[model samples]
Target chain A: MLKNRTKIKVKGLNQERAINNLSKTIRIYNFSRKEHNISEFEVDYNNSKHIKKMLEGQGLEVVSLKSRGPAFFIRDFFKRGGLIAGVIFVLIFYILQYSFILKIEVWGGEASQCNLVKNFIEDNLDSKLKHNISTEELEILVRNNFDFVSSVSVAFVGQSIVVNLNPSLLPDEMGTGFSPLVSEYDGMITEINLIQGTLNCSVGDIVQKGDVLVYPYVTDSSGKVYEVEPKADITAQVWLSGQEIHYDYRILTYRTGKSKVQSQVLLGGLVIYSKTPDILFEDYECEVYTKQLTKNLLLPFKLKKTIYYEIETEEIIEPFEEVKEEIISKARQKALIFSDKNDIIIDEKYTLSEGGGCHIVDYVVTVSKNIGG
Target chain B: MFNFFNEIKNKASGIDYNLLNEYNIINLSGKLLYVEGHQGVTIINSDMVAFKIKKGRVVVEGKELVLSELTSNTLLLQGVIIKVEIF
Candidate 1:
């Protein structure tokens, strides 16, 4: 075979004598002497064995013999085809899995509308192969086909296709039709600047929720009523209430600083190797992390590592003052969510009641804001 | 007498300055020796190597001498050279 060509190293106390003897018997194609003791000779593989035996017979040691050529590799590959074939098969399988879509997701739409969009996507994809459709093309098709969608985005995460849809604003919601400006909160109308409609509530007048701050119907001096869209800047001092309960006594679970880690190899969801015998902790938490060959390929083999932490529970008693302050702060934050950035807080009052090992805090905040919606 | 010998030799061989300089030897710090216009190897050994030149022979004596490279017309020797002689 073409692989049989190789080199042999001859070593002895007197390498020069060996080279002189070998050159006379067989042609020394190429030779190099190192350290005046060891010498390497390049010879045919068939001749190498014979040369080694002859050199040994002559009291010269053959240190090492190795075959070098393309034929040797070809022979080795044929001898171990199963191993190489498995590696190639795995690489090809991973590539093919990621090339196709396995899942589709549609978010940011009503349930019925989402289902409609999903069906539309499925119908369009059903006629063609999975990999043939591009994500950008799909986003454009969805946006063009659905008139109600204002913005649509599509992305591919591994094998899943995620679509995001933003619904368009309705005409009434855009504030185009004639409508009354009603107070959204019960408050005293401190300021009112009417732009188009007649102001129903005057400044310093108390108004209830649903009360119209600006009326779209305007009666002129001649008793002629003209309807127009109500536009106004109505500021009011609104009182907002927020309540929260803080537990004075609580049960807390914490790790006991003892943890156990176990590793296992899973093939097709079946555990092939596991060193752990059994879990011993009665109250414990387990976190399992898995690493696979590829995300989209869903390869049969994966490495799973699980960490178990032993936990203990204890009863904790909190101070009443601390609990009350915490609840009041949370209540204030809740009230602020309803107020705008330009709104000013006029007054704040926190009332606390103790019952059932808990402190119930009710916070009332007065703020000046535009109460018209 | 020397001028008479030089005239006779130059006339007999028709030697020019460039041709005479062809058999050149360059010694670099006594470590490397470069020889131009070498003919063939007469002897090769661990301590010495001899090559044939146009007029006579060039002998290089060294320790652990090795022919690092050998071509049809030129050869390279590497080792600790102690002596170089031309005869």
Candidate 2:
């Protein structure tokens, strides 16, 4: 048996002393939830306020001071009137919310028509939400409202209502019979994947464009031929070729306006006066003019006037292997235009000729692709 | 000293003196100790708690010692109890 007691929790340092003091002051019982610097205990209901004030005087925080008994529960129930009212409101709202159809869904209708029907349902949802309209009544109302719609069914499914409708539609035309699968390009058949069809041709067979590979009819074990829509995947090795002619070397000229001039006088096949090498441009197109200084052919005495124009030259030389690879990649890209997305290249060979001041490259890529209808 | 009073009461009431000689009935199970005969909590701390009995005091030594239940006659001490001493 337990009497109604006031449960108190105090927060401060030296909680041990606080608990000991409360035990001595009042008859404290049911000590629990003890931690470092925090204590919880219960005292007599009449002494709760006095104990709380006594602990406060000692600078300890009275964290919680509450009563634990039937009397306290009754007192709290009347004190928190707004809380009880809000709880009741929520319970009633939950029940009413689930009972009403919040949304209407159309299963067999075009997207725009579904939206139109939904809008129509929403406009009249006030009465439906209030339980004034039933599912059967709503179905008949929808059938009579829309002349194009014939069969209508409105069913309550959980929180929403589903409407099944069939609108009047015109009959469709007859479909054409299935045709035999044919090759789109000329190649040698390498592999054939047949899911459902009659094989008209086998592997290793050479086929041209529009050659039939699978027939539209399949024969049963009893020899009864039935027309079928053939389903198959055919693979054939077709060669795609691309060629490019490139010059063996490329020449580039730089744009430079700087020039330098040099004049020299020579005697007896020996240099008498000349400009130093450092004064001349490293690379230039030089123009030279020579005049006979002495009229002696054996001595060869001459005055030489030279003009050097400064020019900046930048040369980029790619390795032969890299250039060959670049050409092959470009050729492969060009050949890919003639192939389909599902084609897988099995073999690739390129013929390269590097002579006669030009490079001739020819690429042939053999790929397997689906060709049957 | 209280044994003389207990002997007189036992002779007059036909009660066994051995049961009354047991000052504090300590029942220790794992982390919980129930002291049936406790006067009051003398000292309570996270590491230790001391209770005053009839003639002596009982000190509980452990980590995170808590007075889970407390009354004038019974005390429930909860924590990792290492030892208990009656002085």
Q: Which candidate is the best by lDDT?
A: 1
lDDT of candidate 1 over A1-373, digit per residue (tens): 4535657777776555554455444545445554356766666676676887788977778888888778778777778979789878999998888777887899999988888888899888853335677878888889778856888998877887889999876444233347788999999989888877788889999999999888786667867565667878989999988888788789999999888889998888889888784778889998999998456565667889999999999999887786666678998887677777888999989888888888888888999998876
TM-score between model 1 and native: 0.31
Candidate 2 lDDT over A1-373, as tens digits, reads 2567887888887654566555444665545546666767777788876887889877799999888787887778878979889988999999888777677788788888777777777776656563665778778777766645668898888778898889855222212377888888888888888976689878898899898888777777967465676778887888888877665466565648877778788886578899845545567787798899887777878998887777777655544565777877777777777887778988988888888667778888889877775
For candidate 1, the lDDT comes to 0.75
Q: State what share of the real interface contacts each candidate retains.
A: 0.00, 0.00
Best by DockQ: 2
After superposition on all CA atoms, what RMSD does each candidate show versus the true structure?
Answer: 33.1, 26.1
- Which residue runs of candidate 1 sit more than 4 Å off their true CA positions? A1-176, A252-314, B1-87
Interface RMSD over true interface Cα atoms for each candidate? 9.1, 9.2
- For candidate 2, write residues B1-87 as lDDT tens digits: 565445565676666656665454544665988886676665566777777778888877887666665545667777889889899
For every prediction, compared with the true complex, DockQ reads 0.03, 0.03
